[model samples]
Target: MSEFSELRYLCGSLVAVLLASILLTRGWRSKHRHLPGPPPKFLVGNLKDLPTGGHEWDQYAKMSELYGSDVLYMTALGTGLLVINSFEAAHDLLDKRGSVYSDRPRLVMIKELMKWDWNLILMSYGKNFTTYRRVVQQEFQPSTVAELYRPIMATEVIALLDRLLRSPEDLIQHFRLMAGAIIMMVTYGHKVDSVDDKYVALAEAVREYSAQRPGTELVDVFPILKYLPSWFPGAGFQKYAAIGKKLSIQMRSAPFKMIKDRLASGTASPSLASRLLHQSVDTGGIDQDQFAQNTCAVVYSAGADTTLAAMINFILAMTLYPEVQERAQRELDDVVGRDRLPNFSDKGRLPYVSNVVKETLRWKAVAPLGVPHATVSDDVYRDGYVPKGTTVIANISAMLHDPSVYSDPDTFSPDRFSPTDQKSEGEPDPARAAFGFGRRICPGRFFAEDSLWLAVASLLHVFAITNPDGRGGNGVKGIRWSSGLVSLPSPFPYKLEPRFSKAPELVSAAERT
Candidate 1:
C-alpha cells in the first residue's frame, strides 16, 4: 500500500510541473516578437536600450537602421513601444488604418498632474476629441484661413519684420512674440502688443513649467505616483504640478472669459472663440461654451509653439545655408517685387520660396517624435502582432530625414524639392510627414503653412540673415538642437539686415497700413 501511495504522488508531481511549464511559456511570449529591435532582457526588458539625451529622434533613426526594419519594437518592464521609421510604414499604420491607431497613450504627467486634459495634442481618441476637432477644424479650414486668417498672418509677418529691424538682437523673443501675436488675434481677438503681454506670459509660463519628457515620465509609467503628497520623498514634481494646475486654469480661462464678456457686451471682435461662442449650442450634453474655450486654448498654445519653432528653424537654415536664402530671395524679388512685402496671393508665384519652407520643415522637424498615439485594440500589421495599449510613436524626424527618400538629406538644400533640379525630381513633400499622420494630422495645418510661408517670404524679401559677425556665407558651426517633442535650434549668433536699401522702408510701409 505504501509503495502504491508513493507512485501516485510522483504522478501528481509530474502533472503539476508540466502545467507550470506551459503557463510560464505562455507568459513569456511577446506579441511583437516578430518585429525587429534591440533584444529585451528579463524583467527590465530594454530599459537600458531606450534613447537618452538630446536628439532622441536621431537615436531612434539609427536604431531603425540597425534593426533593419521600418517598424522597430521595444519594451520597458511589460509596456510595448512601437517606433515607425519610414514614411510608408507610418502612413500605413497611423494614416490608412487610423481608426485602430488614432488613440493617444495616456499621459499621467500632462493630463492628471498638470491638468492639461483639454489640450487637443494629447487628448485621447473619443467623442470629446471628435467634438474638439470639429470645433477647431471649422476655424482653421483653408477657406476660413483665406477669408479671415490670411490678413492676420500678413499683418503679423510685417510686424515681425519691423521688430527684427529694431531689435534684431532679440531674435528668438521676436519670433516668440510674432507667433503669440498671430495666435492671440486668431483665437481670441486679443492683441499682443509686446513680449510682456499678460496672456502670452501666462500661456508661456504654463508651457515651460509643465513640459515633460514626451510621455515617458516615471509618473506616467506608474500613475500611482500621482497620489503622493508634495512633501513626500521623490514627490517634488507634485508641487510643480500644483503650480502648473493653477496656471493652466488661468491660461485656458482668462482670454476665453474676456472674449465671452466682450460678446455679452456686443463688442467682441470676430475671432475663433467669439464666432464659436455665437454658434455654440449644446452638443450632445457637453457645454458648447466650454468646448469653444477648450478648442481656442488648444489652438493658441499649439499654434504658437509650432509656428515659433518653424520660424526659428527657417532662420537657422538661412544662417547656415546662405545660398538657399539667396535663391529664395531671388524668387521673392522676381515674383512679388520689392515694392511691397510678400502676401498670400504670391504663394503660387513663388514656388521656390514655398520649397524653402518645405525644406526647413524637412531639415528640422518641429514635433520630431509626434505626440504618442496608442493602440485601442490588438491588431496585426505587416505580419506582426501589435498588442493593445502599445505606445505608437511616429518618428517624424526619421521619416523626413530618410536618405533613401531624400538624398543627402542632412544638407539643407531646398532645390532637392525643385522639379527642375537635376539631382532629384520633386521629392515627396515633407509636409505630409512634417505636420503629422492621419486622424491626428494638424487641423490648423492650412493656417500654419500659410503663416510659415508669409513669415519666410517676408523675412527673406526684407532682411539678409547671416552670421552675427556680418560675414556672408560663414555659417554657425557645431549647431545643436534642443531635444523634446518640439525641436528648435539652440540660440545661435545671427545678424538680420535689410536685403536692400528699400527693404526697411517697404517693411515700415506695410506695418503702417
Candidate 2:
C-alpha cells in the first residue's frame, strides 16, 4: 500500500478508537441513570428544555410540577445537570452531602481572564475557600456587624427616607440608592451621597455587565467555545471578559487605593477591606491578587445587587399587599416609634417586621437558582448517579415555594413566619430556608437581612407606598418584573406620601438622629 493510504487507514483506526472510548464512558454513566428525566436527544441531550432569559425559572417551576423534585439530565454539550426542585432534596444534597456538592461549575469566561477562581461565591470547596470564608465570617460576626454598622445603616436609612419624602414618585431609584449606600459603606467605609455618585455609577455598571441575557455567551453552555481566539469577531466571551477586567480594575483598585491612602494617613474607618488589608500585611498568607479581586468581586457583584434585589422585592410586596404593610408599620410604630428610625437593636422586639423581610426573600429569592454548584465527586442520590463534575442547581425558587413545606406557596403571606404561628403549630418556621441551606449559603446574609429590615421598617413608618393612580397619569398601575439573573421589581410608578400630616417634623426628627 502507498504511504498516503497507510496513513489514512491509521487515522481512521485512531478516530474509531476514540469514538469507542467515549461511548464506553457514556454507557457506564447510563447504567446508573436511575433518576427519572426526559429522554435526551442525540448530541443535544436536554438543551431544548432549558429556558432562556426571564422565563428560565418559570419554566423550571412548570417542569418541577410535572416531573417531581429530582430532575436529572445531560445538556446538549454533554454537561450533567441535576435540578433539585424541593426543599428536602436541596437540603439533602446542598447541606447533608455538601462535601461532594459544594463546588461551582467551571465558568470559562470568569475563570480564565477575570481570575475569579478564588472568589468566595465561585470558588470550589477546599482549603482556599475555607480561608476566605473564615475571613468573611470574622468580618461579619453578628456583634461586630451590628456594632460597627448600625450607625452607618441608620444614616443611610434616614437618607433614603429623606429622598422619598422629597420625591415620593421615584421609589425605584430610592430603593437602589438605599441598598447601594449601605453596601458601599460596608465595603469601602464611604457613604453613597447620591444615586448619581461615582460609586453608585460604578455599581450600576457592574450590575449591567453581570445581568444575564438570553444566549448571552455561548461559552457558558458550550465549554469548547473558550478555546476560540479573542481575535474571532462575534465571540461574545471576549467582550464579556474585557468588560469584567475593566470592572475588576475599577472595583478593586479604587477600594484598595482608598484603604492604602487611609492607612497612610492613619484615618481609615473600620471595615472588612481595611481589616483584611491590615491582616494581609502582617500574615502575608493571602495573595494580593486573590485578596483584591475576591474582595471587590464580593462587594461589587454579590454585595450590592443581591441586597438591592431583595429590597426592591420587599417594596413590591408591600405595594401588592397593603394589609401586610400596615401590620408591619404598626409593629414598627409600637417598637421603634416615630421619634427614631428603626435600628438593629430593635430587631428582636419587631418580630412581625422581621417576618416581612423573611417572607420577601422567600417570595422572590434574589437569585432563583442559588448559584449553580458543581459535583466534586460522583454522587449517588437514591440509586441515581450524579457523575463527578456534573453541574448541580439548587432551584431555590422551587424550594422556597414548595407546596409540601409552605401552605399556599403562591400567596404573599407573612403570617407563615410569625413567631406565634410556628409555635402554635408543631412545625418549623419557613423563614429558616430563606437564607439558604449548607456551606455555599450567602455569607453576607446577616448584613443583608439587617439592611432590609431597617430600611423596610423605617420606610413603612415614614411613608405610605401606594400604586400610583394612572387614570390620567403615566404612573405604573400593574407592577411587572425585570428579566435577569437577579429578578428585581421592574421600574414602576409609585406614590410615596408621608403617613402622617406632620411630615416636616418627622424629617426634622430624622435629621436630628
Q: Give per-model TM-scores.
A: 0.92, 0.88
The TM-score measured for candidate 1 stands at: 0.92
Query: Could you give candidate 1's per-residue lDDT for residues 1-513 as a string of tens digits?
Result: 464464356445644564455347645446444578898775456889999888889899999888889998887656778999999999899999999999988888878888788888889999888878776777789999999998888888888888889989998999899999999998888888898998999889877875653446667756666887876655666887788889989998889888888888988789888777777444455688778778888987788889889998888788878878888888888888878888888888998899898998998899999878999998888787888889999999999999888989889888788775454468889989998889999898899899998888888998988876554444536667777777777777778888899988998887788
Candidate 1 regions with alpha-carbon error over 4 angstroms? 1-32, 212-215, 280-282, 420-425, 469-477
lDDT of 2 by residue, 1-513 (tens): 664465456445644564465466774236565466667765446768776656466678787676764565555445788887777788888899989988888777776665666567878778877777776766777787788877788888888888778887777777778777877777767767887787678768766766543233556644455665666544545766877777866866666677678778988777667766665532237775457446644765777777778877776666667788888888877887767666777888988887787788888878777688889998788878888888887677777777767778767787886445446652345445555668877777777777778887787888887766432233224445555546666665456788877654776687875
The reply for model 2, stretches above 4 Å from the true place, is 1-29, 212-216, 280-284, 288-293, 419-431, 470-484
lDDT of each: 0.83, 0.70
All candidates: CA RMSD (Å)? 8.3, 5.8
